[model samples]
Target: ELEHFEMHAEEPSYWPIIAYPKAWSPSAKGTGEVIYLQIYGEEDLEQYKGKLKGKFVLIDTIRNVSPPFEAKASRHDVESLFEMATAGQPTPRPRRRNRAGGFNLNKAIWTMLEEEKPIAVLDRSYKGDLGTVFVSGARTAEGRARDSAKVVIPQATLSVEHFNRIHRMTLKGETVKLSMDLKSSYTNEDGMEHNIIAEIPGTDLKDEVVMFGAHIDSWHTGTGATDNGAGSSVMMEVARILLKTIEETGIQPRRTLRLALWTGEEQGLYGSRNYVGDFFADFGDSGYTPQEMKPENENVSAYYNLDNGTGKIRGVYLQGNDAVRPIFREWLDPFEDMGAQTLTLRNTGGTDHLPFDGVGIPGFQFIQDPMAYFSRTHHSNMDNWDHLSGEDLSQAATIIASFVWNTSQRDEKLPRKKSQEEELEEKREAKKASKAFKAVDPAGSWSYEVEIPGMQVTGDMVIAKNGDKFDLTLTSDYAPDEKEVIEGVQIVDNAMKFDYQSEAQGMLIDIKMNLDFSEKSIEGMMTAGTFGSFPVKGKRNSM
Candidate 1:
């Protein structure tokens, strides 16, 4: 049962087309010689632009392969889970600035494809080996492929081995001819899709609802079994078990149990966001910023989600809602034997839970074992039923069923975080009650010592005040002649923080410093990303 026959080519035969059901792609059938464009000069692009018409274009360079040396599957250990449970506020990294200047070669190539109208553009997968290709949506020259007005040239991603073979043959001056037919059709022409929602009516609190769901949509490369199909199966199994428990025990929930199978979740959470906007929040022109809260917004207790592959529930990510720590601890107690014990305040993104959490409702996603989800499956051709674990799915369903039951019978709804209006009001009140204070003058030379992993480093930090702003100059003992000047130094109260970037021994170093200022000394920590944090001590030098 093929949804649509994507391609039928020569030796390196089949490759999945990169387009969704609603995205635009041509139903093309053609046979043409494969050509690899090698544009070295401005005139070369023009020469190849005229020759690309009715050809299978090799658009990517050959990929380098590496052996898999590490284990792909892993479970959460005690140390790692403990770190997650006690993690503090994350330090912000400097925003990356694109430094590329001059002619854009990649854009020029795509523009040529759009103009010449090639039979199909071919590229290799970014990751994966041994014929496991990852595939996703298509792209047009100007706008998005999902935009109906954009002209999307046919495109597909091949396995790295096949793509490299074709590329090498062409590089060796051998002609490669390919015959392909892509049979793709568009459905739901009006651009309408739906989400499946069912509910079990509560006995006493019929209006109040407790929801559980998983996105049913996935990438078309494989069956989407591990990425989200596992979650969907677990949710359905939870529903079945709940219905049986109710029938046998003759007990009804205090709040309605609602299950949602959302569509268009892979496409920026369209189904869940729209449902929340329609029922709970009044999203104005931006379609995401909530301008007004509706009446039914208060009825939703929480939304529990599972979509991280077929791994047993280890615990839960609290998503920064500290109020639910004790409540979740009690709920997770019954499942300690099933390995669901840990609880963390860390927030996980990229799922249907985001919409519910965005609008001030409590939304949570469970912590699961990472059994080859990122290494092999997860939107790749290997994300099929064969990779799913039945035992893991069963454990997840049992834990989720108990969680939903406990939520349904709670005396009150789960506590919510501070809303935008409440937070804004607090800021206003605090501002009105505060007095102005100036930072202590740190405008002199200081002797600095940083205890890094291997050794202690000594440096001199000179801060010079120019009217209203201060500039920092640092000279390390390791590089006495190389003085690094840093700008945008921020000093608030008795603390100072800044990021210093430098090059040492052919490697780039980025160190973030958080220093506490005193009358005669400074103490702090310098955190180099991935290299971990180190202690720093400094003494003010007598002028």
Candidate 2:
């Protein structure tokens, strides 16, 4: 599991060197224990062997912050959020889930590259808070943003106070004797970011594709041990096992299997999204609107994303696809003993798969135990090689490998639910015809025609105008305004809660339940919202 991007924790190291004239003078050879070298190009690290020369370069930029492990472990914020989501009583909390305010490290470097076009970057990872420097970004709400971040950038490091000596010396009358020893860095894996990609070609349906991925890039601060360092390794391991097993078993997938180790995942799912967008666009996914992107090819299977912190696999999120339950049930049969057995039809987001789901493509994010990830490691200073769990990772890799294998070998493609955006628009249009749609209460005097799920999450809500009354009946779960108690309306607040209710006034009879009103939320504080009914029975005279 730790084999892909092998975790390496770098112990603290302190080194020293001296500067020289033209960086070659013998007098300056042993002058000092510390040397401040300036880089001259995107690939050149200015290294002087003996003396001082041209420009005195400012070098190093890195930060380190520790984790409040004990404090975080006691807090169950994440636990509450996940549990509430699974039970369908979505939280009312406003979660930002945003990265630190931007334009700092990534931007400053990119901007400097754009303007100065330096040979290379000099960076020093900060260990504690005493040595501090804050950088800002180039964007605000008003300006037209620049889009020059097209490639992966490179970086190097030095000590802050040691490097500052050159800055002070050059500012004085001293022409700061400095030298740079630069080597060609962009020659190999040391320079550019590589996305490891592999694919299992489909046999029966060769046109379809099922992609799986995780980011591989991490801050140089601590070898990126966690905070996605583990994610990258896990995905690789998953790929390895699946490929090996497929080869050993001689099993060919029905859909193409592509695995990608994304770049700039920490910055955002840049690599994965760009890849998906470009791939689908090239093959014509045909996303005319921002919400719906269906390729002309029906063979394209769903995309599976695994990016939760490294913990034992608990279950796989369905991403609101109730239709996927049976399929997942079948696929999970093999790994039921591994403990990844639960499948909930709840929507979970915040990762690469979000982009796909936003565009109407079926995407799934697996649920995993967080373990001590949030409390102690993750992106903190403590996140190092030793933070990873072998057994947990192995368990995860096994499940993911099997999942990818099964998905790739599926005979038909996964189905995508209607985009929420389109559904919302349809709902808005349905409201205009107030008189056309009516709500009839089954208990009051309405007739029952069909049966549906015990809890109706949502559906068409129509209240028809009939003189003094509103005729209403829902095709799904429903609730009405309880406090005001409209002349003929029934409210389903905690005290007067009712899962099933019917209303009939003269010939019109209808039965419906409010989608928002659930038996689960019997104690929580809730504010009132407007309600609607549908006209079913002959209640035209009663209205």
Best by TM-score: 1
Q: After best superposition, candidate 2 residue 191: deviation in angstroms?
A: 12
Worst 10 residues of 1 by lDDT: 94-103
Note the residue pairs that clash in candidate 1.
none
| C-alpha RMSD by candidate, in order | 10.0, 18.3
Number of backbone collisions per candidate: 0, 71
Model 2 segments more than 4 A misplaced: 1-85, 89-194, 282-298, 426-543
User: In candidate 1, residue 411 scores what lDDT?
Assistant: 96
Q: Write the per-residue lDDT of candidate 1 for residues 409-519, one digit (tens) a residue.
A: 989999997643354345444544567433468889899987652246799998887555557778777655456666657565666777755433222345677776666
Q: Against the unseen true structure, what C-alpha lDDT does each candidate score?
A: 0.75, 0.45
Tens digits of lDDT, candidate 2, 53-100: 222234442233455344333212455435633653111111111112
